[model samples]
Target: MENLGVGKVLLVEDDERLAALIAHFLTQHGFEVRAVHRGDVALAAFLEFKPRVVVLDLMLPGQSGLHVCREIRAISDIPIVILTAKEDDLDHILGLESGADDYVIKPIKPPVLLARLRALQRRQVPQDSVRGALEFGRLVIDRSCREVRLGAQVIDLTTMEFELLWLLASAAGTLLSRDDILNRMRGIAFDGLNRSVDVYISKLRGKLNDNPREPVCIKTIWGKGYLFNPFAWEV
Candidate 1:
């Protein structure tokens, strides 16, 4: 396999041995990996290193990983891939809610981790064929800048959130099933259990100030899929 050349990665793992192993694996695959052991200093390292992606462990010495994830997200739209030992759905949901773009279970497989990282990197690159912003009344999604705005107010979105919104906006007036969403965004077919899409949609709706129960922008089609109402953003 060739090097992806995705660039710097900030790894926050308390286990020294595991961190070294993961860092080594990533380094071999053409990434500059910086491993931090404490959650409290993770933000500082992030600012200094300015990595393209963050691999965070939920359990840490100082602050928790979730806190770090939120802190980093507040300032940057950098993609975050959380590492958790627990296989529970709640933990995964928590990680995604904390602004992480993806989650990897511990007892980690380097290859799987690598694949996730690559997927995120791929999303960061704007599609050459699709250019400019998609404007809908007061709402505007600028793919070139990776920014979204409602009138004069700019909306803050995590990396994954932006990707999801862009996907839906690009296909305005279309009903995208969960399976279609997962496969297009994450390159994996939905198996009726992944709730990441729903979580992200809720977040986007909240940020866009769309009423959850009576959402006009992104509508839920009952048992079918989601639709981006091209006509609903006039307000």
Candidate 2:
């Protein structure tokens, strides 16, 4: 983020007042915010702004927020928090199932929104950067070399694949959405499908002999996303 404490937010709400107020409050807290009223415009802003997160309203014009959410999930992994009207439970779960990392109801209080944003941010930073090595069974990730070793065999990986492995292994217990991986690692402008991530992750698992069913290391969070078992790193 260009700014420090406040993370960047791409706000997509038709209500001009709410968008401005939210942006102002978040900006005061050192967050970089960009407001877009239309879903299409919001998509454009998201790519250009490279926001760490996004605030989307389900009732957006030009394009429905649900559609936007699906489209965004197709490319980047930036965390997204959907804003929906009360009683819009269907849309809410759909948003999550569609790939949103979180959601907030309408009539949002600025303070609450800020708090939620912070909590999500806190979850992403690693708790043990100095650990040096991540060992999941016979598979080892040596941070110093930025390499993964399965027993005596070293598995070669692309830059993105290595990063994806690192991010998941480091998080351990946390669930990582595809959007979060793509956005943070590759930037929001990344143009690819979740399948790209799936393919890379699948390849890594195969090389490591990570069971696709009842995986011992990285596990798919079904309905939501993927999570790495830090306990899997216990040597």
Candidate 3:
């Protein structure tokens, strides 16, 4: 696999040896990696590093990675990949619920983690000089900065959430199949059982203030996937 000039990475892992190894491996793969061992200082390091993405360990001394993830999500839309020891569904669900873009369970393989990171990077929608932004009534999505504004309010979205929203909104009224979305966002084919796409969509709807019970902005079409109702955004 080719490296697409991947940007800065902030890695938060308590294991010194493992952190050093990951840092070395990622550095060799053309990523500027900053390793921090504590979860409490993770936000501070993140602010200082200004990393394009984050690799956070689930277990840390000062604070849990889930807490750190929530704190990070409160401020930025940067991609976050969580690292955990357990292979349980609780960990996976909690990681995603905590606002992580992806997760890697331990007994970690450098190449696999690298590939996952690369896949996340590929999801970023390039800023188009001509298009600039997308306007849908009261909602405005600025492609240049990946900022979403609903009238006077700024909607905070995680990197994955924004990517999914942008993809759906870009298509506007058209129905984008789950397979198509998964492939575009993660660079992986849908495996039928993976519900990450749905998870992201649910998060997106919540952030957009669309009622989960009957979402007007982003509608589910039963077997067909989702459709963005551009007209519903009008105040």
**What is the TM-score of candidate 3?**
0.86
For each candidate, what is the lDDT?
0.90, 0.73, 0.86
Best of the candidates, TM-score: 1
Better model by TM-score, 1 or 3? 1
Runs in model 2 lying further than 4 Å from the true structure: 1-6, 126-134, 138-235
Error of 3 at 53 (Å): 1.6
Whose lDDT is greatest here? 1
The pairs that clash in candidate 2 are: 6-31, 76-179, 77-179, 77-180, 77-183, 78-179
Q: After superposition, which runs of candidate 3 have C-alpha atoms over 4 Å from their true positions? A: 1-6, 123-130
Residue 229 displacement in candidate 3 (angstroms): 2.0
Give a tens-digit lDDT track for model 1, residues 148-206.
99999999888789889988998999999999999888888887777889999999999
TM-score per prediction, in order, is 0.93, 0.57, 0.86
TM value for model 1: 0.93
Q: Over the stretch 1-235, how does candidate 2's per-residue lDDT look in tens digits?
A: 1322337788999999999999999999988998999987877887788877888998888998988987876776556788888545555557765666666777898888887687666544442443478877677887666568877888765434566788888787888887887666544422333354666667667666679777867888776678887666445
